[model samples]
Target: MVPVNPDVTRFLHDGRLLAMPRRWEHRRVVARWLAHATLPDLLEPLGERELTDRLSELAADPVGARRAMVDLGAVHRTRDGAEYWRTELTEYDELVPDDAVEDATTSEGLHRTLHLDGRRIESVATFYDELDRVFMAGEDRRLRPGLDALDDLLRGGFGAAHGADRVTVVWHAFDRSRDALGFAATREHYLAMLADPRFDAALFRGRLADLEAGRGPTYAELVLEVFADHPGVELLLR
Candidate 1:
């Protein structure tokens, strides 16, 4: 469930923010929320386009939101506007005025856990399905069953994390997932990707060949590779 605090959510409707708050106090709330929500890797600097694209997922006026965050000291950017990073929000906590604003999602110390039962994954399809179900908390919206969707889902700001401070994903029965998504499943996965015009046919063909020779990474390993990009998310394989 999303961490709900009236002080922070008064500016939101559904999941997307309704509007960038106009009042200084109200704006601080929204800015602080964006600082926590938008960036998946706080330590890495993002190009303007990347940062704006991430922000666009949460607000209609991403450009304005970006500017507001910079102005409010919630984010920092290069003078040339080429790169950006989230700023520490500890100083702003005292300015919030409302004690109730300390919600789980915004609390830096709070850590949440999400469990992925690998015992339930029987195939590549079941892997994505179980992932989507667990991450979305059984809500509407099935993931595309592809690496792109997996990246987005793990990045937070929606689904399970929903802007939470930190998330620890435990993949139980991981050995089962490894076997279920092993050689055959990896070959099948690459073959399907090879069929798509958007993918590099040559590269996928090479991967398929490697799989046939019993030398390539399994589908589960690929999932681990993607998880490596998100340092904020701790992935525990059991």
Candidate 2:
């Protein structure tokens, strides 16, 4: 059963409705604005006619305009030649704030574990935590037909590792799934960590399946295996 928290739902609904898409677009524009142009070597101010024309052209046929802009040297293009409004010129440093990076990382981590049910029932505990994030305890499992049986089997609790935080056994039946599951954690960091060569979802599933089948390693062994396979497990297991 997928349980919805009324408070969270209401808050999200209000936030979405109140948010201005245009404001977000403006923010992007401001964040990416360039103080100087590459071509002509003039102190090119942002929003000048030439730049606006270029921006408009780019907006209209973004793919072609981007290529043209790259050729003009007005903007630095990525390896893929996607033009970005030049911010800082440092080669090694990120232009965006560290908090934004952290947030993106947390969001990626949350998304990876979400929507895990349609595939094989590899890690019941892992799958359960993802679901619990969106739904409250005693909530109906929304994705699968055999949820009640699964919930009963799991006894309404699961293991979740908050990012760099202590491990906690969360009751799936609780109302505060967000706090308990670390839903606010940065997904980008989580996903970046998963990029490790040894990280294997297949292996994790295999171990989980073994545990479920009564022929697998103990939970401790499986956890250890996960840690061994993924150095990033420290992020999740901490």
Candidate 3:
């Protein structure tokens, strides 16, 4: 078992550090870093005072820490030069789904399951509508698009009405014409998709043969990835 670092633990658990700072940039940086750094990672190398000291040194240098935290949204400076916790700057929003059932008398009960395969592709609009219905009904549904073109077609949106508990999006090469060329093209396409404004989607690339061979993360990981990638459709992860 790896040891934990006490300074990082104290840094995270201490109420003084957790308080929100006034600067929006600082808060954003803190939120972003906190969101990405898990408790275990912070605790790794348990009882390693040397490692902890390095972290402490970084924390002590407010300017350096602020820059590192910038990626996570924590960019503030105090009189003493120490950083305080802040909120993330992600652009999450709330919009009522078009298919939400209004009144109990006319409301359809929740639609829980949606299976996407080649056959279901024809009713794409209805599929999206049903996603809205399920989300409004307070259920999280994982969405996985096969290609960048497909993800673009859906406008980089889809998820539960509420918010995501866990979500991820993965892109794998399943039916490319040539193995080597297909792999490179698939990765490039996925990177381009990530940059698309209409497609604020995450990308996960895996071996096409491995996926086709049925050796990969469990079904749950796949579902969670779909949920994580589509914050607009994050309610599905719940």
Candidate 4:
């Protein structure tokens, strides 16, 4: 049978089970496709068991797929697990589907998943500013929150800026973020993120050494250099 979504064709290159994509952009596309194909929006708020049963029919990794849907803002669930509903995010528009849920966050349609919000941009100095307070407070608890904001800046503004100004800002933010991540307050989160299949510890350390050696790497260059063209490094912000 033809795949319900053609964007999924790349992963379906094997022409059997839909293999998962390693690239963040492709993974997000596939995630949205799964979210639509499963029709979670059409159902009433489902129990965890019911959702899992439904998802299992759609993918080899039903559980991971569920979490991806949430992260993509395609669905919503109460914290207590008693309820979940299709999200209002209608902004995702890479490959359009007729039955696609019309949630507010939806972007273009069907195939697109990594909706880069122009409004999420921030100056690199903002990262430094947040970390300075955490450093001065002598508290680790404030570390993750500070880093998360920095991650947002990088994600939203990653490719938007260029030239010397962009480089300088990124370098400064990278240094500050490194210090914050290395701190005890946020070390565990940083390490756990390394375990993500996407994060590259070797590339990260090599880039750090290069930066310390006065090599050139604005945030964009550094991430692409170390994270293989994806900001898998930012996943550490969690």
Tens digits of lDDT, candidate 2, 1-238: 1122333233224222122123543322222222132222211122334554554421443344334444444344334332244322221222222221121122112211111121212233444454454333344544232235333322324322233222212122222322322322223223433465665656555644554566655433332344354443221211
Displacement of residue 3 (Cα, Å) in model 1 is 35
Report the lDDT tens digits of candidate 4 across residue range 121-234. Answer: 243343344333322233334323333444443443332221112111112223344443333323343344457667778755565555556663544333334433333321
Residue 149 Cα positional deviation in candidate 2, in Å, after optimal superposition: 20
Candidate numbers sorted by lDDT from highest down:
1, 4, 3, 2
- Residues forming the 10-long window of minimal summed lDDT in candidate 2: 99-108
lDDT of 3 by residue, 1-238 (tens): 1222343344444322344345766555444443233111210122223323434533444334444554443322223433232222122211222223211110122222221221221223333443344433454544443433234323334433222222222112212212322334444544555666766463233433344455544322343354555554312211
Instruction: Enumerate residue pairs that collide in model 1.
Output: none
lDDT scores in order: 0.73, 0.32, 0.33, 0.44
Model 1 regions more than 4 Å off: 1-107, 195-199
- Candidate 3 Cα outliers beyond 4 Å, as residue runs: 1-58, 71-149, 152-238
| Residue 138, model 2: Cα distance from true site in angstroms | 22
Judged by lDDT relative to the true structure, which candidate is superior, 2 or 4? 4
Q: C-alpha displacement of 88 in model 1, angstroms?
A: 29
Error of 2 at 10 (Å): 49
